[model samples]
Target chain A: MPYVNVKVAGNLTEDQKRKIVEGITELLQDVAGKPPESTYVVIDEVNRENWGKGGKLLSDKEK
Target chain B: MPYVNVKVAGNLTEDQKRKIVEGITELLQDVAGKPPESTYVVIDEVNRENWGKGGKLLSDKEK
Candidate 1:
């Protein structure tokens, strides 16, 4: 089974989530030969406060 | 940079989160020779309804 985890720095709408799940699964099937039925796609929506880049939290970027 | 993702099937308290983050960061530093400051440890507390195994949703298991 191919377990794929996708992390993003905010919330996603239900429609967005569905598309992402489909896209990632299709990409894996096309590139890695993984079967969609056995693939596990776990999406993580991290809070901006919990993620950081360049020594600054994503939560602070909006300021 | 070594990016680590830790997924669990429920919510975690702040204390639990602190411990887990520290543990994973230290593990990578010790085993992979990665620096703790540079390693990224992302924790995903996945809801049961969003996860499945053996053709069954984890949310159904408790019922």
Candidate 2:
């Protein structure tokens, strides 16, 4: 089983996560031919300041 | 750049995806600590019928 984990900025409803997870599971099944039970997906959120790109945090870069 | 893609069952808002992306970026930065620009994440959605587990589609198993 393949466990797909997504890490991102915090703040989302369970419904939103569910939809995203379900969508991904389906895609993997078709492309990778992995069964739903054979695959697991998890999302992880974090602080914007902790994320940096090109020496600047994501939140700062977006500003 | 390392592009993280998540394939799941369809249906999620842009905002929700954004949040998920941001959260994941932060985690990689902390754990793997990769620069935000050095990494990219994408979410792909699909139909439940396409996802199967234990010889049953996700939708069918859920029912």
What is the C-alpha lDDT profile of model 2 across B1-63, one tens digit per residue?
A: 335766656556676667656765655555444688866777777678787667887788777
DockQ of each: 0.11, 0.07
DockQ of 2: 0.07
Best by TM-score: 1
Chain A TM-score of each model, in the order shown?
0.91, 0.78
**Which residue ranges in model 2 land beyond 4 Å of their true spot?**
A1-63
| Candidate 2 per-residue lDDT over residues A1-63, each given as its tens digit | 445766656444676667656765665555555688766877666777776657887788777
lDDT of 1 by residue, A1-63 (tens): 788667889997655666666777777778988777787767677899999999999889889
